[model samples]
Target chain A: MAGYKRIRVPRNTWNMWLWGWFLVAPTMLGLLILNIIPIFQTLYLSLFKSGAFGRGNQYVGIGNYERLIADAQVWHAVANTLLYTVLVVPLSVALAMIIAVLLNGKVKGTSIFRTIYFIPMIAAPAAVTMVWRWLYNPQFGLINYVLTQLGLDPVRWTTDPQVGLISISLIGIWSIFGYNMVLLLASLQEIPRDFYEASDIDGASKMQQFFIVTVPLVTPTLFFVFVTTIIQSMQVFDVIYMMIDVTNPAYERTVSLVYLFYNNSFRYMDKGYGSAIVVLLLVLIMIITYFQLKAEKKWVNYM
Target chain B: MGIASKAAKAAAYLFLITGAALMIIPLLWMLLTSFKTVAESTSMNPFVFFPSVWRVDNYTRVLNQNHFSAYYVNTFLMMFFRILCSLLFSAMAAYAFARLQFPGRNFLFGIVLFQMMVPTQIFIIPQYLMVDALGMRNSIFALVFPGFVSAFGTFLLRQFFLGLPRELEEASKLDGCNIGQTFLLVMLPLTRSGLVALGIFTALFAYKDMMWPLIINTSAQSATLASALAKIQSAISVNYPELMAASVLAFWPMLLVYIVFQKQFVEGIASSGGKL
Candidate 1:
């Protein structure tokens, strides 16, 4: 009986092991082919000048990288992408934090406000950008009309090189803050009621309690939101792509890394150069994330 | 509460109301403009608030003359398959990663995490090349190709699966159920919320996906709503009414779904925030 028990146990273990592999096989295979393999392939392809229709390729080791460094347009793209991230992340997060704190209180119409704010996050970027474009039109736009009503000169929202990135960033903040708000609100709710009660007992004012209790407790989530939002903003493509055309004067000022990669890879068919550009984007994200992680220990408080 | 607190609460309400208005004005403008005539839409001197005739012609014209219908069908088809595949494959893989013991599990999951960390553009060039090699361009299959495996869904669902009580699986095992049976009968049903969350996210991501469809399916007939809207915007840059109409048509389905599943959408998105 004991020998039979041991044999059955081993057989069951074998069966479980086989099933585990079977269950994971499809996803593993898909990721390997589509995602995992491609990372290396992109790295390799960046080395060679891609041939037409993806055929005969001549290896140009470090050549694409060299071109990427000297290319003024590539630098513009990097600067624009970073600037977009810089402009979008802090303002959106701060606004989201404020909104989340207010909504966390005994506020009426909380869900209604949430629903309205979140609409832009789910709306197709192409569609959202279209509406914004109409509104941002220098001539006959509602915004310009409003400006004229207020006795101020109508500002060129989408056309001007200086204003284009800012205009796109406004749309970025509008679309994204709701998502951050939801995240921050979730984290806010996780804080125990005891903390607030204790702070109140200690003669802490509402503002003081918020600064002393709420902010410290929510830092973990704040950190997460900041990291993810930065990564997301770094890859901004659709809104800019829809709003700014290559022929537009603001194209150089507004073109992001992903947009540049898209133009090079598909439009110009310079896949090698595009691959190199995207690799630079990947490195930048990793470095930023790495620093964020290292800095988390200093400010992010755990409860 | 003191008068000071009352004043603070009022200030909060004011701020929230203003923020909400800013959030919704663009959408309200889109809806209002779609019904206006081209002249009315572009009018600056008076700035038409409501359409003079409240025309449905823009909607009808876009639906009838352009590729809007095709975009609808294509986008729906792409979303449906992408959601279905991601749920099935991700659940299976997540179950294994969360519950099953296997060699190289950590290494494999590391790969998944690596996939999640990298910018999606890194995968695009090779994925495009792969689809081209398979002659799958300009097809629904091409649109649905890259989403067949979702590392994010796997990671998200694995967290859900891990949170389930282990005793249930033990009980099913003691009842003479095998590993597959235990997973299917005792475990899978418990992760319904996780499955739903993943599904909601997958659908949303699939719908708003612009670059892939734009790159893969260049033809009007094959384009998804997002890519098609982009095409029309570029094609008819100055036709404000038609463009607004196209924007409305492209986004209303998602808006409708959001309205109906408001609670679930909030919970799903919020849950993602927690796990991340």
Candidate 2:
């Protein structure tokens, strides 16, 4: 909007300016109310001891942060979230790349395969959570029944404290795979045919072309997938909340940062602590995203 | 060479078939288990894949028993308004940022970008407080409150608008059309694909959203399918068949959307990944 001189080519520019303001007002207002203002509010709420039913607020600046630092459950949730991210992020991207590369070939039923892969993405998360919870049932579950057929012991998918987080990560991997594959496939398609043809003319092996040409070309999308997946993994809530009940011994193992925020704010009526937890997540995401962006300069091949 | 090519094709088919099976089995498993009787569902000794008797009645029973039909209506209504309002606002705002030369345009757009970079979960507690203070809890407005405009949508659409030719806007100006008229009458039509993509994503996100609805709409009457299922999950602890049936019901609207707009849906994802 800054300029050296006012150069107008058309009349009624003032009216046009008003029109522009009118058109942009809704989203601007929405952003202010929904995003900008809430951020500062959450920061403010974090500084207080939330009163009865989250009514009164007695500010004890940085006290909530001090408590959160000592809170084992918060750290445990963070560790669990990071573990889930570590498990899902690389695995999802790698799986998506392999599947995308396979489907990139002029294979029979490619569209059908793509459609099938994306069906999980089509269903709501709640539905996915429900179905997986059904499958993870201890006694009557399909997975356990399958294990018995093979004469292997039925492992507790959601019940065991050791395996509960892994179980959540399994669904996380499954849900993310389709979207990542589609993106990687899109990135794969963007790789010019000339690169492959030149590699073929050079007598480069398929693996060599994949390593040298395909990977570099798809790095931008891969990086995008990586950042988004990890960020989302940090916010993992619904599946954990739905599948891991309060009675489950694995509740401690499977709780995510957002889930913990939900428990504190809504369940325990501890808004200040919940705000601190979410603020912590917000800071963690910002730092990771910062590093990702910094790394992109060296790694991501935009072209 | 011919033999190697043939082997390559076969290997590709094998890999894709296996991948598709992994992708589809859970959903197929859901549909199958939904038709089973509760006794059969819980009977691990036999390990039945299909129901001994076709229980299509399970769908009808779950739909009626848990106030699920009402929740479905509530979800669709909220989704419709959210999608409509969000699309309209995002498009207008995106066009403003992309095309108009307004004071503080870059600053405003920077704010939008900041919103995109921040995790949205941070806003939920305050958003909840706002809705509560307004006494709008347990209403559809609560569900739609925080989603009036999508930062992601505006950002994506702004990118789309930036790619449009300047000649179109110039020609509209030459014909005595103002910026607003030109945008609505001329520029808006050009971003159909972008709009459609935003619409699809918004609809999907709205449908998949669980926590907000669970928090705001405590009553099943105003709850969405996602929240309702979360409710039913805790309420009806057992009855695996009924739970499976409810999960299957949750996909019906999405199923309809997929059946109708399958190509656009796929293209939308493809282009979203490709364009950005």
Candidate that would win on TM-score: 1
Writing each residue's lDDT as its tens digit, candidate 2 over B77-151 gives 888988899889999999998888767788888898899889888999989989999999999899898888888
User: What TM-score does each of the candidates earn?
Assistant: 0.97, 0.96
Return the DockQ of model 1: 0.80
lDDT of 2 at B232: 79
Chain A TM-score values for every predicted structure, listed in order: 0.94, 0.93
Q: Residue B274, candidate 2: how far off, in angstroms?
A: 5.0
Best candidate according to DockQ: 1
User: Candidate 1 — which residues are off by over 4 angstroms?
Assistant: A1-9
Tens-digit lDDT string for candidate 1 (A163-207): 999999999999899999998998899889999999889999877
Per residue, candidate 1 scores C-alpha lDDT tens digits across B138-255 of 9999999999989999999999999999999889988999888888888989998888889988998999999999999988799999999888888888888889999999989999
Task: For candidate 2, give the DockQ.
Answer: 0.73
Candidate 2 segments whose C-alpha is farther than 4 A from its true place: A1-19, B2-5, B274-276
| Tens-digit lDDT track of model 2 for A179-211 | 999888888887889999999999999899999
TM-score of 1: 0.97
